[model samples]
Target: MARDLRFEPHDQPAGGWGSVRSLFRHATNAHSWSRAVPVLPKQNKPGGFMCVSCAWAKPAEPHSFEFCENGAKATFWELTTDRVETGFFADHTVSDLLGWSDHALEAEGRLTRPMRYHAPTDTYVVVSWKEAFDDIGARLKAFEPDRVVFYASGRASLETSYMYQLFARLYGTNNLPDSSNMCHETTSKALPESIGVPVGTVRLDEFDATDCILSFGQNVGSNAPRMLHPLQRAAERGVPIVVFNPLRERGWETFINPQAPGEMITREPTDLASQYHQVRAGGDIAVLMGMCKVLVDRDDEAREAGAPRVLDVDFIQEHTHGFEDFISRVRASRWDEIERASGLSRQAIEAAATTYLNARRVIAIYGMGLTQHRRGVDSIQMLINLLLLRGNIGRHGAGILPVRGHSNVQGQRTVGIADEPHLVPLDRLAAQYHFEPPRNKGLNTVEACEGIIAGTVDAFIGLGGNFVRAIPDRARMEPAWRRLKLAVHVATKLNRSHLITAETTYVLPCLGRLEVDEQATGPQIVTMEDSTACIHASRGVAPPAGPHLLSEPKIVAELAKATLPSNSRVPWDDWVADYGRIRDAIEETFPEDFKDMNRRMGTPGGFPRPLAARERRWNTDTGRANFKCPSSLNASFDADDDPAVMRLLTLRSNDQFNTTVYGYDDRFRGIHGSRMVLMMNADDIIRLGLTRGGMATLTTVADDGVSRRMDGFTIVEYNIPHGCCGAYYPECNALIPLSHYAEGSKTPAAKSVPVRVSAQP
Candidate 1:
């Protein structure tokens, strides 16, 4: 073995001195004392900017220190004193910059000026916004609306997303795909049909009352740090927190609050996850369905004996559909398959079900672990099926919580950043703007990649994300993405997406979330919708990174003005001048969702958007929640053809959030100085003839002719399920085929990629 990988496990609890040390270290890395010091107090508080990280709900009564360790890292990473100018880009060619890693590129700091690719020299040069907008608009006019895709990240606020989507729809394309399509689109897809809502129904306050929590495929410590507070509290109250994941994550073990003086003094950690079952990758459906089957059997037993029924018979009969058929199918399912798939015995499932039956309210939480699979949609629906057996949905302290990453992913989707024409209110949008909107269905993330590869899509307008890097099939995306006729990115910092330039590509500098955005109407506040359905205001505290930087709303408005020939009906300048007018328009268009958005945004914690599930009112075509069953309980890909074939899942480092790699050291996992190490079960290491610290190369086990492989990954034995392994994201995205996606939602199956790992060549 050429490389010697360290295998030191972190024995300390999550979020203690470890988090405190990491916070200061990250701050120092970003030179936070120079800019972030002042804004630290203002983050997640009233009249302050939101953290541009995970969308964990801010408590109504926040602690003195409102932000989490990683949240501060995100803020500091944004508020860095470093700046990139025209000379920097002039010195580096596209090919030269492509050699740098994602972390190293972001480490160069924020982009200071608008830039356009000079294809002759293969470098970017300073360009005036007026000329850039005019030229881009002219070029875009040459292509059909359907050929251009308007992509967004979760960093964009509601106002920015709304204006951006409005501009795209008016320009005659419904091709508005955002980050949510890649992350939690399964939640949006499953919940709407299963519970008659796209988002979960539980409020932040109601979470305090939950007696039990069943977490699936989510890591609370890294992805959503603030969430550890509630989970810690629940643990202390004797809540049975059960976790079903491929790996025994550090977050599922223990957490010590850095903010708690007693804990900091005593060094005692709260034990979390009373029962942690290491379910196999892509086995979430089987495990969840097994729990549901146990509940059904218990209910029947109680009914036959004339005892109290285990199931919520009344709620199921009144609010849901397909119960009888679903139960029958579940009962018909084989136990051997369930155990083989979930990696848990029949007794384990029954025990988990017993804990569920004992609790009055339960909150089922999940993340990409469940959603990024071929059966992602089915996995999520099965989660709903588990909750439905005991009437978990639409109750206080009980509901499905698909914890989202990034600050405003759900907010962007809520404001019409969707590819589906029916999902967006095209009529209301056109009626408000005095233009007939296009009703054609557009491309999602996968479809956009297909469009780019098939040479059907020629242009891409990206708003605040590294779209090219975030999606699956990077081997194809990078080359195909570079061939675009025109690509425009509205961003604050330099990302790999900008480097993969199109024939005519522009990187437009924009204000970060913490930066003051002064406009014709003075300073403006943008709103973001968190996972809890609360739409709150974010007021920036720091000055703009550069004088030339524009707010997202202004960038979109200017683009709209230049692209659409200055229509009086649209009034792009008017909306940018006063953001309140945008809120008024949003209220006018979706009167039910945002009844008093303008009035509520100014209030103390803002207000919750109306969710039909929260009020137990089904909004489906049949006006009822639905129970669904998968074609088969075996959710995993067939790996019997090769003994070396194992399910591979992509993981986020402790330092990174999504594609943004803050640092190479994954502190929670005890990983240092590397992100390309593979986590595997010890037994698998022995069975595959691989030693600890050995180098292994992973190749995709797909039927496609294309051989996707990544080499020279250091192996580290860990507590993962048998026949399953783990690797870092975007880097490992090469192994995931673009064609491999959820059956319905089309989300990339990142969690359960079948791969053959052999000794590195």
Candidate 2:
């Protein structure tokens, strides 16, 4: 048996260096860090250096230092001291690189040159830029554009993503898969169907006016730390912030602003969440339904009497449709059933509803936790229903904010990286570029992986991202990657995906957003869309880390120039030479309300992209917002569950972002030095007859017998609900079967995997 490792709790005051150090030790895998040698800028113009971490909009206020811990880590990783030139590849085989961990490979330093895998030698060899381009062009010309997949990451600048989609469409394919597939694709899919828009309805400034803020499953401090300020301000204003999650996150309870001198000096922190409810995993849909049912019941009683209706009937009548049907469904839902499913008492539900009813303005923010469920889309729709009851959509301090994960994931979608079968953006490409693009619907991330596994996808081109590690079923994904004919990655550093080499693989290093890119047309400005659909220009302040590092836009342009025929009217060189021209093309292609893309993006504090919510204008066919009834009430839970299996929820460590593991410590959870421990309720352990520190093997109860047996996992009894178990993601991703995903969103039900756990022998 593995030794029971015990962690000593520290009572140091929050915001103190001791607390910070403790958090770092636990979250960072206790790794020693060499302080970065700060590089003073030669020029201090407001260059476009966007934070590569989160989607927090760049504030109008100018500060001496304005970077979060994650942002600084992103910057350092991009501008690291190490370099992996051709010589490094000469000493390592593809097989050897495969054996190294993702962190170890990237820690070897940045890739400085183009290198290609030689099948005979089983090693990567240096290739000149010209030769590399020629090889890519030849391979591209051999297949129809639909056969190729163009995947982009959120880190890619707006300028680069726009050019990438344009090039792919001009080459006659809508095979544009992206990172959004992994995170907020549900928000994009569900919001449009319900509200006629695909973005957050509230602006950042709206938080100031909000009376009550409800956050479901979003860890604001770790994912988007800058949001802490707005949340803190809301708390200062006496607004009640309610949080509902399966686990208790310290950041949500109280936060000490690292930026404020007073707080930093005194080690004082402000209380954030007034009420924290630990809802069962995948129970959000039921909880939301209960809230709506309460509202509906109250409104019906009010209508029966001479009193005014509790619901905003005017807003429902004027701007929304199908409210009557939605109300009927909400009223029919049983409170007893809702309570059983949600694992929250009727008093708790009523208290939460009372807060919402009393508040004049309310904002509900959520993260991937709400979306990574079987009924993810339905859950979002229900949240919309609750907000719509009070007409919160277009109000100052009220709306829904789907906190997106990547820096530029929203930007990629804005620039047409989509697989919408009906609205492929290819027809618009044809009208603008005078070429008929492919009309066939393209593959999404899941489909792309399946295609690779089935041997239909011969070549893969990643604009940016660790595709293999990010996807589910890694055991299958890695082998599928090996079966590919050609795999190419345009990246800033090495990652797990690079190790999943094809027969012939190429690693082309690219410039980071913070690094300057000098092209034939001179320095360029990149644009990015924030979570609120605000588009802003980003300029690189520092020099490129290496001479061989190319900008993503320039790389895409050059690749297109090499691949496409001379007769193609896309103007690849012109767009690469000047990003403004690319913006002009984007403006021409998607002629929406705001078309002066370059000029508007240059404005200070940036400008909000054209959205119907700003003006309460619905773009739906009926010209009004629509209300949707969930197809089924028990959509989130399994209809037929084995009595032995319990649902597992996958989460991230405070120090980690997505699949990027900065360290092994989760400070907020009081976890240190390891991520192999599972959090469960004490009652649950007693009920299952499992002891603390007992090793458990989790197996998914799927029909395919595709169970994942993770051994030597220590069980730590915690405050989670009885029926749910919590474990860190990417590590626990193996327990989530890909086939058990949401029907409409296709999002992996990472938050709810029905699994059976027993003591490991």
lDDT of 1: 0.87
lDDT of 1 by residue, 94-167 (tens): 88999999999998898988899998999999989899889988898888999999999888989998898889
| Candidate 1 similarity to native, TM-score | 0.98
RMSD (CA, Å), each prediction: 1.3, 2.8
Please write out the lDDT profile of model 2 over residues 1-761, one tens digit for every residue: 23534544433323336434643443233221332214212111135467777887656553445555555555556666677866776788878888875567777767888888787888778788888888998888887677788898787887788888877877777788888877788888888887888888877778889999998988876677777778899999899998988787777878777657798887778988888888878778778888888888888788889788889988999999889898888888888888877888878888888888888799999998788888888888888988888898888888899998888898888878887646445667777878776777888887887788788888889998888888877766788789887888998778878877887788888887777778787888888887878777887767777887778887888889888877456787788888889889888877683488877876666677878865789877677888888866554557435556787888887667777766555666767666778778888788887887788878777787554667767888877887888888777766766676776877777888887788887
Which pairs of residues collide in model 1? none
> What C-alpha lDDT do the candidate models reach, one value each?
0.87, 0.77
- Which portions of model 1 show Cα errors greater than 4 Å? 1-5
Best-matching candidate per TM-score:
1
Candidate 2 regions with alpha-carbon error over 4 angstroms? 1-48, 62-64, 421-425, 639-641
Give the distance in Å from residue 453's predicted Cα in candidate 1 to where it truly belongs: 0.5
